[model samples]
Target: MALIRSILFNLLFFPGTAIHCFGVLAVSPMGSGPVQAIVHSWSRMHYWLLRHVMGISFEWEGKLPAGPYLIAVKHESMVEAIDTLRFADTPVVVLKRELADIPVFGRVTRRYGVIPVDRDAGATALRQMMSLAKQAVVDRRPVIIFPEGTRVPRGARPQLRPGFAGLYRMLGLPVVPIAVDSGRVWPRGFVKRSGTIHFRVGEIIPPGLKREEVEARVHAAINALNLPTT
Candidate 1:
């Protein structure tokens, strides 16, 4: 049954995502408002598919921060990535450089504006990511990033990549860490179990703290919902 639901959801998700991407591209000249509406609608459609076809739903705790704040999120599966759009107000997401290198999806991400981080580039990548992030702050757009750099298993607690601390220091925006336990149901497999993924927003951390302090605090906060690993 889970396999059938997963297959059905993907059947709808992939084609629908492609249409949403192109829809944003077609309305690019109309500016950010229309593009954001289409983007939000895309997320809405995704959740609808999850609920109706897969019997998956989500719940949130803590007040979602208002204004342009640095949002640090746990990356357990693709579920939280899309959910970021639901949490923030039309924010610019910082994602892996490879996602921006894909064929069709690449063009859409570029058009929508993302801070693509190339981990292989070391200092150069951090510099570029900060540059894009600074502009996001200037535009009063909230910035959402997976501080772990890549998705971790449900119970894994890895220290955040340095780029997160860099953004925290450079952007000078208060950091709000969100912990997600989505992998139990949204595991990277052909089957998706029916369950509720919990999202917990931690207390906001002030900016301008030393790198080590900020990183340590965020590391603990974002992993608040992580299950104990064997």
Candidate 2:
């Protein structure tokens, strides 16, 4: 049953997404407003399919703070990445350079002002990211980055990446850390199971602390879901 549902979901969702991509491409010349509206629609379409077709839903622990701040999210699956776009304020994500180069979607990422991180580029990449992030802050758009730098399996906690700290200090914005338990249901496999993905939004961690202090607080905040519940 799950397999059939997954098949049906891909049949509808993928084509629907492709059409929206083209829609974004056609309206890119107008401005960021039109572009973001199209992306918002695409994110909504994905959630609609995720719920109706796959029987998956979301449960948030706390309210997401107002934007123009940093959103440091737990990286478990692609679910949270797509969910970020659902924000009406429409954040500019710091994602890998490869992802930003993905055919048609890559074009959308650039047009929408995504901060593409070239991991191998070292300090140069970090400086470039800070520059782009500054522009996003000036534009009043929230910045989203997977502090771990990439998706990890459930229960696995790694130190926050250095670039995350670099951006934190550079932006000088409070960070809202969110822990997610999506991999249990939204695994890397093609067939997905029906379940509620929990997003545990932690309290705002203020800026201006040293790198170690900031990293420690955020690391704990985003892995709150991994703590043993007695």
Candidates in order, TM-scores: namely 0.95, 0.95
Clash pairs (backbone) in predicted model 2: none
What local lDDT does model 1 show for residue 183?
90
- The TM-score of predicted model 1 comes to 0.95
Query: Residue 5's C-alpha lDDT in candidate 1?
Result: 90
TM-score of 2: 0.95
Candidate 2 at 172: error in angstroms? Answer: 0.5
Looking at model 1, report the run of 10 residues with the lowest lDDT sum: 221-230
Candidate 2 structure lDDT: 0.87
Worst-scoring 10-residue span by lDDT in model 2:
221-230
> What are the root-mean-square deviations of the candidates from the true structure over C-alphas?
1.5, 1.9
- Candidate 1 segments exceeding 4 Å error: 122-124
